[model samples]
Target chain A: MNSHDPVSDCPHIAQFGEAALVLDAPGAMDLGAQQRIWALDAALKEQPGIVETGLGMANLLVSFDPDLWQAEALADWLHDAWVRLPPLAIEGRVWEFPVIYGGERGPDLPFVATHAGVTLEEAARMHAARDYIIFAPSVTPGFGYLYGVDPALVLPRKKVPVMVPEPGTVSIGGVQATIGMTPGPSGWYTLGYTTRFRHPFDPHAEPPLQVAVGDRIRFVIEKVLPC
Target chain B: MDNLALSMGNALLGNPDHAAGIEVQTFPMRLTTTQPHLVAVTGAASAFLDGTPLPPCWVMRLEPGQDLVLKRPTTGARSYITVAGGIDVPLVLGSRASDLRNGLGGHEGRDLRDGDLLPVGPAPHSTGAQDFGAQPPDETLAFTSASDFLDIRVVPGPEHGVFTAAAQAAFWQDDWLVSTMADRMGMRLSGEKLTLAQPTELRSGGILPGVVQVPPSGDPLIQLRDANSAGGYPRLGVVIQADMWRAGQARPGTRIRFHRVTTAQAIAARNEQRDLVAALRRDVARYAELPGFTR
Candidate 1:
């Protein structure tokens, strides 16, 4: 496939307020659309006058200085850039994490299993079976939106988000999965916990977090240590 | 625009070796300068230099070892402090602004803490103390009070039609209170619960600072500077960039009213704000050339 083929599916680009231009892809949360969004973001970052680029699951927000570049100029630039954008090849690192599932680590295991109409053990096995891709960072720092969860495990978000106190708690909301970096309110059902995850916001640390968008993540269940 | 005006005013006052901008939240904080430098404070009116009352939105020279203490604001929630040059912090992602979430930029990528030492950039050879005072026009300041309910203008968002008729009416008609959850990330507004006609499952998409997101709970959240780049909630409208300053200045418990505006009106408002900053820059330049100006 030609890398510079204009993505075939044209995205709807709209002016967001005064300083930003949002590019909305055709499909919601589709991997192809996400990749296209990333490609657009990468291309826009190279253009002049673009102050910042923000990523959504399937959209991109390009913020520019109005004094430096006009909205119409930016929109035109985007069209040209999108046509010349290379194939989305995000060179990302693969990270392996040892997780403790069920029992004390994940109180919502039974609830998730019951919702999926599967045994608790089977649910844990199903969750750990696949390698997930980091879609994007969502809500907070260090929190990644992991994709590729088993379809059966997909659950609706909680009506009232509960404050999950434990950091590194793995949870699922709808079709998305995330690892908690901080003790905060979440609507996702907790499935496990991992100590390997690090806080993404350390001033002294270089690159902050272990994971980045498009990175592959594999969660392995830790072996029980007999006392 | 207030930030740009203060930075320009500080430049005109002569010292170019100071932080061009200072982030002053509501809480009181102190900064003990190691050297005498020219500085300007804008936005909030409550700040002092070495125990003497310092005027807001004006340039003043601080002596070496003088402590600049910013107290709780009387008018605005955030204050901008500009030194001659600008704050000296290693740029992260090409910006001097601190990203507290990612722990990047500014002084160690975090809020200014006690005993945290910061470095200042080098000043231009012509930079020195000058007795020049320039202030931005009151109309340009855009500081809103917690007592006086804020009227923020908004433009229709992409998903504005997803809201129910009653929800749409309530969004503009009902008075929304800024909840305690307000911060750099976003402001959670409390008011009449705005329910959609039907449950709408939106795909997460690009979000801007002023986008008004309606969550499942029906409360509206206005995204701010540090808000996540994207969100999944249905956005009814986005506050115009011209009036975002009002949202930023409004403290918790402040009443807010949303006024729908046309896209053309939003653009005009933004242009008007830019004009004010440009006008203020000219005024500062003219004042600096006065004969009595001295270090």
Candidate 2:
């Protein structure tokens, strides 16, 4: 969601463990915060000895190898980087991800539309109108949890949800729209389906991933790409 | 491939970081060596060398042609082997640990088997804790055939407020048993169903290693080493990093207890683990000037 004010606020960086740090803010999803977190994350990836980075709503966890750098050194490095970023602007990418909504493909779409007081067609139209930012990967590997749910269709997700959804299924759980990469149960709204997502485990693939944390995404209506 | 330790079912080993090693799930593994090496075995079973009882969780020196057999532990489900100077496996992606979910990063993307001449990495400088005069009783853990059981401690999660008060109370009062389906990804536990307060739609949340989350199924899944990058379920607690090493040893049917602590306590516990690792690394550093490292 690329709005100036997110539901949450700027997060202060804190230690997650002896070798990990949590850069957390209490604010809801905001485009500015997400972009800021991504820029720092991108920079850290090039730096040596980072174990892995775990990005979340209002926080970006930087886990590193402590055998090489002391905990204090890592903390200082993160603090300095978070404070001294050379202004990185969010470069919006226009991507038309194909989707087939409704039916078994998206059983939850009609219900979601009805719950939000929007016509089924209007729900699809409004969803496609704005250029959405792919914020972060959800619980499932290829699931892209997105921001900017059209106010007309913003509603809570199912209290009890399906445990497993097929891979490449586009889903919206809450205001966030995400794409499932693997077959597992999920409570996200089944908005549509797509084939653009990569599998969760591909060893030889470089970047071995289809999307990044701050990439921009849009939905291309089905009938264009046949399954 | 004479006799390989086989898995009647799936075998679990809790190596330090779950390094690349031989998984002797089915008994009668025949390890023929070219040189004498020091090693230790730990987990849910028992082990023997040349028909002599071998130690579990502690290191031992092995001679060439010495036969090492890992008999199942009585009380635990998995065991580990930490060779002196450490095992000589090449670290992929900065970890000697296996990426079990993906299976691309350890011992050529497969577990140990017959005829595999495993490479043992050079030794870390150290005080030889392996020479523990005597190792922690490996047999102590192997008390029963279904020997996988442990009670774990938990610190309330970063998003503990997301769940209702009664849910949190139930979390503390209930007994959670680890599922046999557990692995590197996580230990799925069956216990009192957790209820959410807001049930508000949330972003894919930030998750820490060992953070416990209750999904819509109401079962609490404790995230482990190979957990997803992010999640949205209501988290109940996080297993302190130091204690995490103990958790990897947990077996199915193990009963667990959750104890909430402040962030300060968690931080202190984390540092305590770092200190332990640091001590081990310092011992390894003593070999920095040896022939292998002397350029």
Candidate 3:
């Protein structure tokens, strides 16, 4: 049972809209706080009137029926639940992906390396060093936001996002790393691409997603294509 | 999708409110039916069948080989076209709605190209009825604004109080212009730069459609259908669900003004909308016994 103090003068809880409430822990982005949020999400799913729940990087959004619960009362209930609940340590599986760094698959790999004041080889080495924790599910299905990016590779997202045509594109954003599950616009710096897990999301599949939050992900450098 | 408009379109054809319909956003869409069917067009567009002009929010019986054309809307962005039995695309995840980005559900999970055949569900027996019209919900349940700007009702978000007094005042007072970046995902608004009292980079959190998030750029963005499930930008406010249809109709260059309302008021507005839909359902039920009436 690990009890941690929330960031000073933070943990803003209020109505997200007419039917939803959001509890945002405006503190340091860490695993301990996210674990508590996951615990709260699990506990609230069983409660009556709560229609749905979602996880963000370090925040929780709960959708409820307004007729069943008042906005103020629900907000209060969320505060109480968060304080009283214990952190959940999910026993999840670890997945390793073989990745090819640089070349057309990851057009921004050289830029990312240069920005970090490190060579392309060093950047790839730093990125694959740690087993990042799947922080939360992304906007799309299958892939989730991965925590534990090397500090040297930490950089702000591009001012303008470019369209990444390929899925399974390994990219890095501010203090976090993720894999592109679908072709869409992205502001993150693309570092590499992985073919081992090309399509991670399948609607026809029972679970649809093979990985879940609390799972660990490690990337192995399969090959490096010259820029 | 504009739920109210889609529901109304289905109701006009005597179909259930959740029946699958074609959501048309681009202009001058032309289609030819292989069979006779009762068709209804709801939301912003002028519809015509073989050059015979049809009224707005109106439904008509179309004979096979009769071509239908939907011209660009003058007032709104998207229009919904529903048949009697509804578009029978294979349901994915309990919905026929297309996820164009992910390429799942709805017509091969992609845009409907020319000459593509659509499978429509079985319609009811013909009742000899030719045409029926429904009063557009926009006219009956109108959000009145004295100015040219569209008045969208909103509720304060979680981080609403974190903004400076001036920024908060500007948010309510300023008339924001919808930028060209508007799309199904969200709309970027251009107006007074809203800044927080103390700049903070919030950790990503779950966000829903209609949540107004203010990024570092100071311009506020209104999330809409197909919005991301999560975001990191600080939230300013969220447009009420009842008025989301109106917001969805706003095209680029449309002026918008945010009207603040209490949570209770927002819920009350939602109830009003629900009641309106109920009234529409009852009205459509009267024509259900007709041979041409769909389920």
Candidate 4:
């Protein structure tokens, strides 16, 4: 890891607030940038006086106690960490989920198929064919944004969001795919429902999230229920 | 704010055992202690020991079986009760603060219900009644009433330039109303419909409290403490950390206006606020040492 060069992967760091700073990885979302972000998230955790660190799709937010560390020093520390960032070797598990495609389970499946210029069955096959890596948890507890969606199946988000999509609804928006853990408003195009995905947070449970950053996921189509 | 008062109580009582007991929703809850303890009430609420109205931000000693009733604040929305030797709830994620969203922390990861018995940390060897009670300086207390207009300071966000000129102008010029959908997670602000200069799709990224995101609907949402760790919404600006407390105290109908500030200015404001808090802590420590002072 130490043999790796730092200048090529150094991110553009900026101030978020009086006590927090953000390290933004350049370019669109990809595994490389995500790995760099995870590496930096790990590096920041080892620093002294850091209150908390939050990982984003392609960015990392590092918060520190202002009394203990100055803003400039914190920024410098992030730069130093990035320069010495270790090789991306994140340990995670691969979990398989059973999904029901089309019909009432995913009202937007037909819409997504038509938008992507494919038949309903073909859309489901394309979605289930590829393996996805969990980029990071997003929007809700236990909800993860997955990478590796087939570009041919990518679709734009709804102009108006569905106010209460059912929980465990697997959906795609832009180039990313996600699973809804709770019923809430969303703009993603729902393509299926997964029963195997679990709510990632439980207060009494150790390590609240079922999936962490860098985990792998694969969806298997169980059945297509009628709308 | 509760943490600040709890530290003050610990200092005045000469004991490190102190935890903040907060009463949210339907104030004026009564609590009876089994033993004598030093307590202080801060934030947007009033405290009464037995029948005597206790002063806000001042530490008061409670006798055994003495009833303490916390009444709602006339000026603010939340009240904090700091007991010497902090509330003894088993720490979750290394914090005693209740996490309502994840249902962790505090008493069983939930709100303090009626008849709930909270444990307090053991008092240190020097635990004794102080000669003088310490009250926070008036200038140190920042309270906002629902009737008052709020001018919150903000710094431009990463996507601030993507919004149209007119939309940006309206954001700073118009008075936004806090919608009924306000909570610890975030608050929806309704006002001039804000639109972007061009349609853009952003990836989910790290988000912080005070981030003002403008969705396609044009209504701005101010993320709060319990907001999602990351989001894809286009951010217009972020409320300065120093002024976030004001946003937290705002009620549903409160009118809000954004004031743009430079990064340097935001840092300066935060430093100033920290200075005041430090001064208050020092004042409490000094007052507690005065000879022959009593309530």
Residue-level lDDT of model 3, residues B66-134, one tens digit each, is 888999877778888899899999999889989987889999999999888999998745454447777
DockQ of 4: 0.53
Instruction: Provide the lDDT at A52 for model 4.
Output: 90
Q: Each candidate's DockQ score against the native complex?
A: 0.44, 0.36, 0.76, 0.53
Q: List the global CA lDDT of all models.
A: 0.74, 0.61, 0.84, 0.75
Ranking by DockQ: 3, 4, 1, 2
- Sorting all predicted structures by TM-score, with the top scorer first, yields 3, 4, 1, 2
Which residue window of length 10 is worst by lDDT in model 3 chain A? A1-10
- In the range B37-62, model 2's lDDT, one tens digit per residue, is 65655544477778987544445566
What are the fnat scores of the candidates, in the order listed? 0.54, 0.44, 0.88, 0.51
A123-165 per-residue lDDT for model 2 (tens digits): 6767777766767666544536677777777767666667545
Better-scoring candidate (lDDT), 2 or 3: 3
Better of 2 and 4 by DockQ: 4
How displaced is residue A127 in candidate 2, in Å? 3.7
Clashing pairs in 1: B16-B85, B19-B86, B19-B87, B20-B86, B20-B87, B129-B295
lDDT of 4 by residue, A1-227 (tens): 22255665556777676677777876666787788788888776787889998787777878888778887888787777766676476777888889999887788888878877988888888999988888877766675778888998887777878764577888888878888877777888888889886777765577766678788888998987655
Stretches of candidate 3 off by over 4 Å are A1-11, A100-124, A151-166, A182-185, A195-197, A223-227, B124-130, B145-147, B287-295
- Candidate No. with top TM-score: 3
Query: Which candidate number maximizes DockQ?
Result: 3
lDDT (0-100) at residue B245 of candidate 1? 69
Ranking by lDDT: 3, 4, 1, 2
Kindly indicate the candidate among 2 and 4 with the higher lDDT: 4
i-RMS of candidate 3:
1.0
Give the runs in model 1 whose Cα sits over 4 Å from its true position.
A1-14, A64-92, A141-143, A198-210, A223-227, B1-20, B27-31, B49-52, B65-69, B101-105, B108-110, B113-117, B125-131, B140-147
